[model samples]
Target: MAFDEGLLGQEAILSLFEAARWAASASNGQPWRFVWSQRDGSELHKRLVACLKPGNDVWAPKAPLLILTVTRTTRERDGAPHPWALYDLGLAMGNLTAQASSMGLLVHNMAGFFPEKAKELFSLPADHEPVTMVAVGRLGDPEGLPEKLRARELAERTRKPLSEIFLGQSP
Candidate 1:
């Protein structure tokens, strides 16, 4: 997603995280956490940008906010590995996306980042796994993106039809 340099208010960012906090998780063991940085040219922002891969670095820096998503690998209650941690994190992200859309904002989630670097930068514990990074802001001109990315951004959105996706018998 394209994004302008407009700053998102603290309240708005807090609301986004609140939405994420309400996401359902296995046995109510909410394992998702986030490290966030605003595009104010601060040291935190610079370190966050450095975690991005080359391609993401080109566009993500223009967004007003960036967030690194992480999940606790073990269950807090028993110290066992949480099998559904990744799935739970996905649900939380879905909530975040829905909330953002309602607020007239766009979110671009990227896997193109150095997770190891993020872990080191954030000093994350061994049980926490870095999952993805998100860029958040209002929509901006696609012209700001590289020529190839602009083409992709302007291309028609496509998804698999229900008929193809549904393998079971029709209800």
Candidate 2:
């Protein structure tokens, strides 16, 4: 869906992040971290926007909020390779988006970003890796989107069947 330039209240945003914090994680690692910026046009926001790729930057930058999703690549306790960190982060993001939906907000996740640049720009720890970004805001009229995007947003949404996605036989 397209998004309006609607701003979200601090309490509402906090609720979404808090919901993500409670998601189940491998070894209770809770390895997800978010570097978020609002549409107030701060320098930080501009810097974050530069991290997005061309096609994504076209629309994502207009959302009310942008979040750089990072995951700990190694276990925090002993620095061992945390193979499940990315999966754990996905769980957290699931919680966040669910909470946003419940509050009548929208979230759009994208992989089109330069993670290396994001790391360098933010001075994040080497163990923490950026993988995805999310745009959050209130739903808006499809007509508000750029022509190409409007068509894509209004197109019928489709997904692979569970039978096609899963490995084993159907239950």
Candidate 3:
């Protein structure tokens, strides 16, 4: 998704996180965590943008906010593997995106980042795994993107039909 350069206030950012915090998790483990940086031309912002792959860097730097999602790999109480940690993080991100949309903001989640770099940059513990990086801001003009990306942006959005996604036998 494309984003404008407009800055989001602290309150708005916190509200988005608040929405994410309410997402469902396995056994209420609540293993999802986020580290975010807003674009103000600061060193932190630049570092966050630098974590993105070159393809993402081409566009994501223009976003006003960047968030890194991390999930706890094990349960806190028992120290067992949390198989659903990634799924729970997905739920939280869904909440975040919905909240952002409600506030007339756009969110683009990208996997095109160096997770190892993120770990180094954020000083994440051994039990935490970086999952995704989200770019957030207001919608921007597609014309600002490269021709290929602009074309892709204008392309029709599609999703797999139930027939393709479901496992039940066809009638």
Candidate 4:
């Protein structure tokens, strides 16, 4: 998505992370982690932006904020595998998304990144796995996007029907 690209303040960014931190997790382990950068062309920002793949790199770099999301794959206290780690991470992301929406910020999560590269670049711990990258900012004119993307963004939004999505459980 196109972004207005207005820089987000530290307080606003912290609020987003705070919301995510409060999300419900398995046994309240709270394993989600976020690393962020503002679009100020700093070294860290460039490195984080470079973690994105081509299609994502196109629009995400233009967004005012970039965040790298991660989860602890093992129990912090015991170092055992945490089976629900990813699910907890998703919950945290959902909270972050809700908080961002309330703040008039847009968030787009991306799977098109090199997680290993992210780990290597950021020196993430072995169990702290990279999950997704996020682009955040206010909405921008679709015209700011390339022709094909602009057309797509301008098109009517669609989703599967409720009936298709909420199937009745078989007895």
Top lDDT hit? 1
Candidate 1 lDDT (Cα, whole model)? 0.95
In model 1, state the lDDT of residue 72.
100
lDDT of 1 by residue, 29-133 (tens): 999999998899999999999999988988999999999999999999999999999999999999999999999999999999999999999999999999999
TM-score of 4: 0.94
Q: Count residue pairs with overlapping backbones in model 3.
A: 0
Q: Model 2, poorest ten-residue lDDT window?
A: 162-171
In order, the Cα lDDT scores of the candidates are: 0.95, 0.91, 0.91, 0.92
**Residue 50 error, candidate 1, Å:** 0.5
Model 3 residue 17 lDDT score:
98
Model 2, 23-123: lDDT tens digits are: 99998999999999888889889989999998998888888889999998999899999999999999999999999999898999999999999999999
Q: Which scores higher on lDDT, 2 or 3? A: 3
lDDT of 3 by residue, 34-140 (tens): 88988888878877887899889999888888998999999998999999999999999999999999999989899999999999988999999999999999999
Pairs in steric clash, model 1:
none
Evaluated at residue 147, the lDDT of candidate 2 is 89
Among these predictions, the greatest TM-score belongs to: 1
Per-residue C-alpha lDDT of model 4 across residues 1-171, encoded as one tens digit per residue: 899958998899899999999999988999898889999999999999989998888899999989999999998889899999999999999999999999999999999999999999999999999999999899998877888878877889899976777757833
